[model samples]
Target chain A: MTERAVCVIGTGLIGGSLMRTAGKAGRTVWGTSDSPDTAEEARADGFDVTTDTDAALRRAAEDDALVVLAVPLPALPGVLRRVDAVAPTCRLTDTVSVKVAVADHVARYAPSARFVGGHPMAGTAESGWAAGQAGLFTGAAWVVAADDGLDLDVWADVAELAWACGARVVPAAADEHDLAVARVSHLPHLLAAVLAAVGAAGEDDLPLALAASSFADGTRVAGTRPELVLAMCEGNRDALLGAVDDALGRLGAMRGALASTGGLAATVNAGYAGRQRWAAARDPEAVRVRRSRLALPALREVGRRGDAVVGWTE
Target chain B: MTERAVCVIGTGLIGGSLMRTAGKAGRTVWGTSDSPDTAEEARADGFDVTTDTDAALRRAAEDDALVVLAVPLPALPGVLRRVDAVAPTCRLTDTVSVKVAVADHVARYAPSARFVGGHPMAGTAESGWAAGQAGLFTGAAWVVAADDGLDLDVWADVAELAWACGARVVPAAADEHDLAVARVSHLPHLLAAVLAAVGAAGEDDLPLALAASSFADGTRVAGTRPELVLAMCEGNRDALLGAVDDALGRLGAMRGALASTGGLAATVNAGYAGRQRWAAARDPEAVRVRRSRLALPALREVGRRGDAVVGWTE
Candidate 1:
């Protein structure tokens, strides 16, 4: 079967990369950027990019192209409103960092759109069309929302797009994705911020000057642009709260142990074991059942077992 | 004047590296390792190494060599006892990670030794003599203690050795050095451990597989051996407690803002600014005042201002 056409709205890092990847994979791909400069850059790079979202969505609706919302969280509502106005029933998914918030926005603004939330767990600490690369998603996990009562056809379409972009699909509920990212991504960002701030609190430059590999690695993400960090951390506030609480609980116990015993054997050993497990974990074997054998429950079970959807047979 | 002879009491990563660095700089250098395997490896590499601490100390006393106690915190007292038995009045310093604890150990066990605390803020996670490299301390800060009443003659001897090994000397008080490292080094290790454990708590590979640069960088140091981490964190308990308290306070506030207002602007912004400051900082200009113009207070003031001692004039 010929690949479905792709319509990407917002040709910055994620969107521009996806457009390039899909086009390179032989799909009919076009994208729109709110920044005319970015659109021009993408077009100059031989991509079909424009500054008109309306035209992009209308073309997607007419050609049955997959519409990918690639805007940041703060820009999601406006883009969804445009999707509602131009292609309310278009096959849609997004590349936003937070899922449940985007799902809620889709339900409110583009109610009839066949939307499945997605977040490609890949990126560099860079922005703009210039930073986008065709191979960015290769070997990365692309999470696809598998919330119950969803259309499997649209779900498969999204997963196919991810696979076409050289990604493996991990099926998860929107809420679960938010929670997982909160633990792995969002909480790390916040902790990095705190760590960086504390390191600098000395105001003497001694600590900063003395900082070595550990300090650099721990605060690496804290160097990300504040606005981007704010959007992700705030957008997933509910889930991040839970993660923060968990970290705080662990830290509190660690502090108590240190104060009393002067030994961090427990915290250090647990963390050491955790790191070892992370090193030991190879990806679970990929799964490919027939389309008839797959459902939301099976997909979720595969995700819980840490397996990725590699393909589906007839 | 010719360079003084050097003797290192540990031949693990730091000690072995220092021995190589000193020997390459034309200093007469030899070392001892508790591990026979490590000592054999060092000896096979054409360096003078042994497992006999008593013999090493006796040789140092006879040659008046600058004796570097490069053992871990737990091994400091045992090594110092050997120094007391064979070389109680020898010129002494150490490369232990913690400053105050080592100072206390030296005072109690080798009181007559002209002692100065030292810690070269450099290393890799890998240990053992084979992992040591000659350029390990090149351009790194080798902190030499400037505590009150410290014999400037012995302090100068230690600083001269650090400079001879290609490191710039940062003179700081033992307590001050402890506090500084607690913020930049030890604290970061603990936080990395917590972050790693929290991330792995999911008991599913999804978070680990989905983890990208942020997670990897944040938890990088947690992959170090737990015993090493415990030694550093537990050895610097009082200062680490203060640093951890500061981190927890900031985290609590961040959580409050996230829970109540759903905005991490304060934490994220402070962190961004902190990271910006770190990026903007250049190594401070080196100072080389005359020996007559330098004292413990003056050296510490230079350290507080983040300056390094590149040399000293007659």
Candidate 2:
């Protein structure tokens, strides 16, 4: 593996995870954090940590290093300004959840730096300097967005970093990355929050106590850092909105099917069909294999019990 | 602890969990299954198990034991019919997910038997004879529904079983139980199944492979027994439909908020407010303490920064 110096700014979950992985991969890794305590903690944990943003940026500027902006979305503009002031010639990348806004901000403020908007679709609810794990991005998807003007070699280096962290690489436009995440990630978070709220509603401890695994799983993301979720939602508002709308439309149809007096069997069948259709559309091959292995047998068993108690029409 | 004999019919997850807990609590537990292998397995696991429903029912009839119908909803009618013929005098109860349907069936088919409908809102995705755990119902909620004409002692016994198994007891009408489960349990299952279906539709392997804890948690129940879910949906169509509708309406509103020019800040604010409201409604004491905790400076660091950005509104 070709050796590359990597400067990870922010020293948060994403930044810390990357540092740990890169250091393990034998890459020269340096990190910076605003909090001196966090910087000291990272250093104690074996990361070459620093508190000076300019010093970190200057190091990247002096070497052929990859500079990753792993800060929160709201903090991006300020961080980008600092990067531009100190490391105008360094190759830049980011691990922001929402890409379009940050891409726009970079284009406006730090146009001189060779930039690629990226998002590693992986994380836990835990955050900050101490929560970083070496394998956090293992088997995760790394969304990379680059324009035609960027050097192919620089793109490959960033892509290599993603691969080193055990992430599969996917090429997406900044807008597409933002939109897809809004649907797959952000909307789910909001839905979980809403569901949690619903479960928590009323003085009925029975319902809350009765909340089983489904409740726990459904609301897991709702319990995440409320501010961070809020920022992601705010940053990728249009896309998240579209996703929420699409989800609502689908949910409404399901509700309507259930409400109809045409029998519960039919409604369940419709739900099953809709789910199958959506899954097929999202990933046909995996769905085909999984449906065969797990879901098909169960469906067949239900079918064999009796002839078409409920069926779906295209 | 009283040493009363309890017959658990259909030795699957729910039934086996009950038997394990009852046995540990000093109850003489007897179990029956249609398959001789399962019966033998349950018996080998220390319960007095039998394949012959008649023999089990006769034994319960002779002993005046509590007969728990822990079979699928569709199988309930057939089981009730058999129990009617063999154990007509035994105190009857059930662990069905949907109560209204079972209650109605019992009322019509075995009107003479002292019957109560029950649902223990606790389980794992794993099922069958092997998946039963003694602590399965621990810290969970048990819903009990009985008519005024039934024996109070039997009701107390069932409630005691729930407590002995480490579950909190909650009383509701059969209809109420069905409605509440529809909202808190059934709808979430549908959502998970749908979301899984959506992820399964992705063309690339990355999304499915990269599906982290959030995706796994969100879709856990969707990966459950399709037959069981279909049965629950069919059995509690009206209530599930109503809950799905409520969820859809809320999702739509969220989507609309996101799509608006102001974007996600408003939607997030609403979600935060909704969660707070829900928490307050469900457990005022917990919510009060949470609010107080949120007010503390140490916790404020982790509190949502977006609320300030979104600002307070009506």
Please report the candidate that would top DockQ against the real structure: 1
Q: What is the DockQ of each candidate?
A: 0.74, 0.20
Tens-digit lDDT track of model 1 for B1-314: 44899999998889999999999999999989898888888888999999998999999999999999887899888888889999999999999888889988988999999999899989988887888999999999989999998888888889889898899898898898889899989988888888888888996677776677788888889988888888888999999999999999999999888888888999999988877777765467698967655688888888888888999776
Give the per-residue lDDT digits (tens) of candidate 2, residues A39-114: 9999888779999999999999999699999988888888888888999868999998888898888887788888
Error of 1 at B124 (Å): 1.5
Q: Model 1, which residues run further than 4 Å from truth?
A: A291-293, B291-293
Candidate achieving the largest TM-score: 1
Model 1 Cα lDDT, one tens digit per residue, A1-314: 43899999888789889988998999999999888888887878899998988999999999988999888899998999999999989999999989999999998999999998899998877878898999999998899999997777889899999999999898888888888899889988988888889988985777777788888888888888888888888999898998899999999999999999777888988888877876775466688867655589888877777778988775
What candidate 2 gets wrong by more than 4 Å, as runs, is A35-51, A146-149, A166-176, A262-314, B40-47, B146-149, B202-206, B265-314
TM-score, cand. 2: 0.81
Candidate 2 residues B274-301, lDDT tens each? Answer: 5454344332111111211222232112
